[model samples]
Target: MSDFLVSRRFYAFAVAVLLLGAAWTIQSRVPLSDAAGGQLTSPREGFPAPEFTLEDFQGAPLASSSLRGQVVVINVWTSWCGPCRAEMPALERVYIAEKSRGLVVLGVNSTIQDNETDARGLARELGITFPLLLDRDGAVTSRYRVRALPTTFIVDRRGIIRSVMIGGPLAEAALRSKINALLAEP
Candidate 1:
């Protein structure tokens, strides 16, 4: 009887593991909005980037629509994310090098789990000059479908997303290349 009970327990555990694995596989294949009941759809290359209006850290309103006609690099990040911190310098370099060439790098802060003080501190520490917009409720982050910290989207002059990088402490060279490509586009 005890042997039968043990076998039953093992079978149940195995089934549970199999079910979890299946669910994970399915979730991986589907976009987050479809897999999870999220309202925001993930933006992709060649798609019109979702529009969003959020306040900069200074409380001034900034809108994506306002950035049309420029190559925009929108980076979704939080102060506490290690990779985000690591990538700030590279992002700053690209921003400074290309800003005059019509490149606009907007750092979108994930304010749902971050504070303005910390965001400001990080920006100061990194010496980031580009505008840092606060996504107070993570609305913009969700719209961008930024699953990981340091996700970046390169939007062309026409407002179409040209590249998406999720999870990074991206290299300056790579970022510069993407920015240059977008700048080269009409």
Candidate 2:
């Protein structure tokens, strides 16, 4: 009887541990909301964009907070990234076509993994005219949680992140469609 009781108690403890682990896993995966049931500010879609200021190649300081009323496209990339090179023209085209409509495409170089010379050269070569912000210390990259070379975050005019593109030689048509949809929004 003692042996059976001990075995039953051990099994119960094991089950409880497993259940707790499962519960924690599920909880951690779910997005957290504020006390008022509003979406918490984060770097993800439907959340307020994590703000940062960086110097453009011309050394002009541009802050994300300053772009509140404009639809902003934050592209995190390294100069050596092939997809970055490929998408540069498309991004530039979108910027030129939509700038008057309050579209701002910010090319944020992960300068921690790259250099100023190479980034500038690539920009010149690709004829990219949008502001190329340098993340010299990787602070902006860390804030945005950019794990990939060419991550793009599309923030709506109200400063909330509306979409996130992880990796791509993102097609011009698709990019334009997403931006146009957001631009159409109030």
Q: What overall lDDT goes with each candidate model?
A: 0.88, 0.90
Per-model TM values vs. the true structure: 0.76, 0.79
Cα lDDT for residue 173, model 2?
93
- Model 1: how far residue 121 lies from native, Å: 0.9
Deviation (Å) of 64 in candidate 1:
0.7
- Please, what are the lDDT tens digits per residue for candidate 2 over residues 1-186? 668658978789879999999999988774554433454578898888988899999999999899999999999988999998888889998999999999999999999999999999998888888899999999999989998879999999988898999999989998998899889887
lDDT of 1 by residue, 1-186 (tens): 668658978789889999999999987797766653443434988777899999997899998999999999999999999999999888888888888889999999999979989999999988889999999898997888788888999999988888999898999988887888778877
In model 1, which regions exceed 4 Å deviation? 1-42
Which parts of model 2 are misplaced by more than 4 Å? 1-39
Residue 70 lDDT in model 2?
Answer: 92
lDDT of 2 at 28: 77
Instruction: Give the distance in Å from residue 181's predicted Cα in candidate 2 to where it truly belongs.
Output: 1.5
